[model samples]
Target: MGEQPILEMKNVHSGYGSIKALKGVSMKVMPGEIVAMIGANGAGKSTTLMTICGIIKATAGEVWYDGKKINKLNPEKLPTMGLCQVPEGRRIFPRLTVEENLILGAFHRKDKEQIKKDIQYSYDLFPRLGERRRQEGGTLSGGEQQMLAIARALMTKPKVLLLDEPSLGLAPIIIQQIFDIIKDVNKKDGTTILVVEQNANLALQAATRGYVMETGEITLEDKASALLENPKIREAYLGE
Candidate 1:
């Protein structure tokens, strides 16, 4: 068999109350690979990421990380296991300074020295954050806030990073910058990433493989290059 995947969801069924958002969805991300989940609104892309991060509990099926089932783990427990998520809409603390917000990302850890090192690492990763370290999170531009959010997530030292809609509402140039940083993080830190995005073109360009979800089901799975050339994807998502 091929090398075991770093993260796997097998026939996952989850939703709010009785509304099923994910129906038997199964996907995997191998170590050091950037995997993209692309779909339109209400396609269950965000739900998949939330379920994986334990923000939304899976009512059925299994989620496995490092060969162990984690469907029932609480969200607070996930960070300790090296699973972190930078949720949709940069959820930084508007009232807190940039430095403080980043520190909160490591709340579960007790190693102050290591946390300080990680903080410096985040600054190295996003120099803009370092420049505005004392500024309130709400004062930063959208792109800057997004960078802080990503940097904060990294403070947890995650092995599997789930990024939800990282380019939600940003300029094309800023979006390009974010994608570049994501690839850099993957390449340099060996962080396995599972990204949910509506920007199919950019997402496919950055990822090694991708899955297309429609109405809570994965309708297509292929190498990023293959999906980029797909006629249906071009017509529907690529706006060709």
Candidate 2:
């Protein structure tokens, strides 16, 4: 068998109330690889990430992290287990300073000194954030808020990073910058990433492999290059 996946979701089924958001969806991310799940609106991409993060409990099937079953794991305990997520919207604290918002991301850890270093590292990654360290998170522009979101998630020092719609509502230039930083994080930190994005082109460009989801189920799985060249993918997601 191939090396075990760092993160795996097997036949996961989850939804809100009676509305099924995911229908037995299954996928995996190998160590040090960037995996993207791409689909249109209401196609269950965001739901998949939320389920994996335990923010939305799975009603059936299993989620595994480093070979440990984690479907039943509490969402609050995930960060300590080296799993972190940057949700779709940049949900930084509106009233808190940028620095304070980032510090909150390390709430589960007790390494005070190391936390300080990581904060500086985050600032280095996004100098805009460093310049606005004392500014309220709500005061930053849309692009800056998105940067802070990614930076905060990095503070957790995750082994696996789950990103939902990182390219949403930003200018092309800012989106490119975000994806570039994402690849950098994967390479430098060796963080296994499972990103859910509506921008299939960008996602495929950033990932090693990708899954195509439709109406709550994955319909295609292929290497990123293959998916990017596929005629169907081009017509549907890449806007060819």
Candidate 3:
């Protein structure tokens, strides 16, 4: 691991109005590693992701990405800095073609040749997306849309990918497939990934390190294998 983390949140605090979602939450993701944030509903997992992506601003502490303080940067600037987020719910444009959606992801880039190459790369990664390139985004299945969402994020050529609940609402087999692709992306592209998931087992399997959050606090942080073996984790989150 590098001396400086690729992404870091130091005692971050944020929420909607008076409701504080994150209370002194701190975490870090090193280069080329998959780090997971696992937590129950309302535990601030999603908030943390949004905060880091600049969708939500932190009232306290700082968010550092690639040695720059990004806590104050607007959301639009994040993609340009090699930070891309696939938000929850697979938010694809319903009326747009699959290719159009992917193209929108690279709107900040001016290099047409590079964009073309990235589009091809994304298509190669998910053949289904290529097959449905002309189809409207709403026509795809939930699993296919999830794939599209990921593919669109990848079109930005992000150095650090922040994935929020990629497995939500998908079939078990599809979830497995998505996780496999995520691992492949990390291995092949060296993209640092920070994933927030409710599926503890799946997240741990894909990540090298994991953190367990509860009620806006991280109660456990350890190696994925260690967390998987923990009695409390198994009983509380793993349903063991």
User: What is the per-residue lDDT of model 3 for residues 132-189, given as tens digits with 9 covering 90 to 100?
Assistant: 9999999999999999999999989899999999999999999999999999999999
Where in model 3 is the C-alpha error above 4 Å? none
Runs of candidate 2 exceeding 4 Å displacement: none
lDDT tens per residue, model 1, 35-151: 999999899999999988778889888999988899887788888889899999989999999999999999988999999999999899889999999999999999999999999
Candidate 3, residue 82: how far the Cα is off, in Å: 0.6
Root-mean-square deviation of every model: 1.4, 1.2, 0.9
lDDT of each: 0.93, 0.93, 0.93
Q: For model 1, state the Cα shift of residue 121 in Å.
A: 1.9
Model 2, 168-223: lDDT tens digits are 99999999999999999998989889999999999999999999999999999999
Off by over 4 Å in 1: none
Clashing pairs in 2: none
Q: What is the TM-score of each candidate against the true structure?
A: 0.96, 0.97, 0.98
TM-score of 3: 0.98
